[model samples]
Target: MGLFPISVTVVEPGRARTGFRKTAAMRLGSDVGPHGGTPIGGLRAYLANPAAEPPG
Candidate 1:
């Protein structure tokens, strides 16, 4: 992957139950997660609504 496609996610220090691993596991694949195809769709979706459950 190119540098342009890479992204960084920042989490607040000392936050509890942040679900960092769940968000990190999300793939940027066309058929993966709720917001599919688009680049970094999972992060975008999570940011939009953190309380929303991730697609299994």
Candidate 2:
């Protein structure tokens, strides 16, 4: 008998100019400025840029 491997993959939604992004950005505000080397910073950058790609 042979066993077959199962493969699973997860995907994140693409970026869109939804108001939610703006609200989230406002909530983050200066309290969490883009650190330039962290996940939050990536999020800030993503939120700031309308064409920026989402983090993987």
Most TM-score-accurate candidate: 2
What is candidate 2's lDDT per residue for 14-55, written digit by digit as tens? 755457877988887844644767989878777777666344
- After superposition on all C-alphas, the RMSD of every candidate to the true structure, in Å, is 15.4, 5.8
Error of 2 at 9 (Å): 17
Candidate 1, residue 35: Cα displacement in angstroms equals 8.2
User: What lDDT does candidate 1 reach at residue 16?
Assistant: 47
Clash count list over all predictions: 0, 0
Best by lDDT, which number?
2
**TM-scores of the candidates in the order shown:** 0.26, 0.49
